[model samples]
Target chain A: MTPAFEKLQKQLRQLPGLGFRSAERIALHLLVEKPARLPELVEALQAAAATVRRCPRCGNLAEDGLCAICADERREQGVVCVVEHVPDLVAMERSGAYRGVYHVLHGRLSPIQGVRPEDLNFEALFSRVADGGVRELILALSNDVEGEATCHYLTQHLPAPANGVEVKTTRIGFGLPSGGGVLYADSVTLKSALDGRRHYE
Target chain B: MTPAFEKLQKQLRQLPGLGFRSAERIALHLLVEKPARLPELVEALQAAAATVRRCPRCGNLAEDGLCAICADERREQGVVCVVEHVPDLVAMERSGAYRGVYHVLHGRLSPIQGVRPEDLNFEALFSRVADGGVRELILALSNDVEGEATCHYLTQHLPAPANGVEVKTTRIGFGLPSGGGVLYADSVTLKSALDGRRHYE
Candidate 1:
């Protein structure tokens, strides 16, 4: 590989979901396989970088002032789903079950990893809640120790109830994934699923 | 996801080895998780685009002029190993076995896929051979129908021997991969390995 190719591969390797082999593949694809696509990708990256911004209300991706969800009048703004990252919010949206707004924490609380409440987008969420725009706070974070810590921190640090605006905090149910089998399910998932079992119809 | 985010994800998905989930993850990572990396990646891409180019001699990646292998005097330039793509050349280099120069065809003969010799870097390779720069040509292409067709095309189209120059053409040995077992080997690989068997010392 040449210097420029190696340099580009190095940068690509640092990107999420890309390792050495993947990076090499991309570099070769861009430089050798499909040279015409290179400029298009660069233009797209530049355009996205120039336009994409965080929505002030929910911290979701936005082209300008607010994200589509926060700007939508029909969405349940008061029922804010707090997620560990934007992808989680996207996942929730993809399910098409939740029409509520989102609060992207960007990351969960991880004391071991030195991530604190102040490091995340907690202040924006707190302000959003404090503005009396939210009534229900659904914690859709991960089912891990860090996720639990983040949920606990969010519930504890919520703005005190005022003007009859009592924010009802809740966590998403943890259970076996759809189409997953109990026989192959991990102990943690099985335990969580059993604990979260609902009444028979 | 916002318009800008979606645009970036669409572009990312078009790249080699990326899929829907990977595109979404990379989009979130770049726009929300680590925004700083986005700009750095953009810079690297621009730099690579501006600097990286096809080697005039071998079609491998080059910064300005000849590729490292083609420019190196120590390498056996007369013994040219032809490959279907740059990645294949990189694989060969990584193997640390062949010290000869390379000629990247960029593609193999695929009639169904409409790929032909004119669509590849065959002219440059033929010219290189015609110039009496090559003495031996090693076909390091894949062991498939298209690869065999490409080998056949190269051998048939090679410039006739002239000026006391007779180019020797050879094909790479096909066998079970290192660390692979006969039980797990595919029938094609097993047959090739058996056909290519050599006497034990």
Candidate 2:
């Protein structure tokens, strides 16, 4: 391999989910196998980098102002789903189960990693809540310590609901995933599943 | 995802080994998590696309004239390894086994797919062989039908091994890979291993 090729591979390896071998394969694919696509990929990446920006309201990806979810009139603006990252928001969207918009923290409260409430996109969320249109806030964060801390911090800091109504706060439940067997389920998952059990007819 | 983000994801999805989910993750990683790295990636891609090109002599990646392998004086110029693609060349280089230069066909002879001799970098190879330097032509092509067809085509078209000496054409051997159990080896691999069995110590 040449210096330029190696440099390109190194850059590609820095991306998420790309190992050295996979990065090499991708570099070769772009440089040799389908050379024509390389320019297009570069153009697209530059275009996205120049145009895409954080949604002013929710911290999700946006081009001009708000993200598509925040800008859409059909989505429930009053019901906000809070997630740790944009990918989590994308995952929730993929499920098609949530009709509400999302608030991306970009990170959770990780004390060990020195991540604080101020380090995240918390101020905007607080402002959104304080502005007083939210009816419900669903915490769709991961079932981890940091996620719990973030959820706790958000609930503790929440302002009083508009019109003297109480704001309903909920957390996404943890349990065995679809198509997963109990025998293979971890103990924590099993415990959550047990705690979240529904009454049988 | 916004239009720019979606466009970026679609372009990423077209890359080898990236599925929809992985593409989405990468897009979010660039746009939201580590936005600073996006411009670097774009620059790298642009730089590679601008500077890198096929070595006119051997069809390997090059920045200016000859590829690193071809330009190197220490490498064995007389021994040329022919591979189906640049990634194969990169793989061989990674092993640190072969010290010779390479001839990347960029593709193989796939009659069914309408890949012909003219479609490959055969003429340059023939010219290199005809110009009188190559002593050994190692065929490191794949073990598939098209690979075999390509090897056969190259052997038949080779200009009388320069200086009237034998070209010493050889294909990469097929055998059970290191650390692989014989029982787990597929039938075709088993047959090849048996066929290529070495003499007793």
Candidate 3:
């Protein structure tokens, strides 16, 4: 293959899921097998780069003013689902369960990884909470130590009783996933499921 | 996500191995998680598209006049390996077993799929054969019906006896791959392995 092809392959190999062989296959596919797709893919990348930006209000993807969710007046803007990333928000949306707006932290506080609070998108969320419009905060972060630390930081720094309106905070339930059996569930999940069990008639 | 992001995801989904969820993850990773890599990927695609082209002589990837393999002087110019694609040629080179050169056909002769000889890169190979320089043509194609048809067509139409060279044609062996056990091989592979068995020491 040509040098440019190899360079492209190397770049592709650095992506999240692509390995060296997968990157090579993709590079060969785009360059040699289907050369016509190269321009289209480049155009798509350029278009997305130029048109997509983070919503200043929610940290979700936006184009002009605000993201679709934040811009939608029908959505319950008062209930903010705090997620670690835009994909997490997308997953919550895909579940068809939540009808609230989102605040993407972009990352959690990971001291081992040298990711501090300043490295996250916490400023806008703090400002949003201070605005007193957010009635509730839903913690939809991962079930990890960093997620717990993030939740702790948020609750500690929250401007509670903003303008005489109490900002209620609730973490999403951590239990056995839907369709997961107790035998398959880990000990931690079993403990969480038992701790968060609801009353059954 | 924005429309442009979704469009990019759709384009990625159409690639060789990526599916809907993987494409979505890639798009989100590029546009959100690691936005810095987006321009790099775009630049790589544009650079590869602008610089890389098929070697008109052998249909291998090339930058300017000829591919590296076609231009190398140390390789055996009299021996040529015919493959269905550039990746196939790369595989041959990776085995450290091929010192000759390659002719990438780009596709096989599959009339059922409307893949005729005209759709493939056969003219350059035929011209090479007609030049009386190729002493042997190794058909390193797949072990499928289309591969057989392609081999038959090549043998039938090759400019043999050109300048009294008596150009020889060969099909690469189809047998149990190296390190592959007979018990794990399919019936067709077992049959081919049995038929092509060599004399034991």
Q: After superposition, how far is residue B89 of candidate 1 from its true place, in Å?
A: 1.2
Question: Highest TM-score, which number?
Answer: 3
- Candidate 3: TM-score? 0.84
Candidate 2 residue A3 C-alpha distance from true site, Å: 0.9
lDDT (Cα, tens digit) per residue for candidate 1, span B84-132: 7787777666656567899988888899999978999999998898888
Question: Compared with the true structure, what per-residue lDDT tens digits does model 2 show for residues A93-124?
Answer: 65555678889888889889999889999889
Candidate 2: stretches off by over 4 Å? A174-201, B173-201
State the weakest 10-residue window (summed lDDT) of model 2 chain B: B192-201
Give Cα distance to truth, residue B13, candidate 3, Å.
Answer: 0.5
Chain A TM-score per model, please list them.
0.82, 0.84, 0.83
Q: Is candidate 2 or candidate 3 better by lDDT?
A: 3
Segments of candidate 3 deviating more than 4 angstroms: A176-201, B161-163, B176-201
Residue A85 shift from truth in candidate 2, angstroms: 1.4
Q: Pick out the ten consecutive residues of candidate 3 chain B with the lowest summed lDDT.
A: B192-201
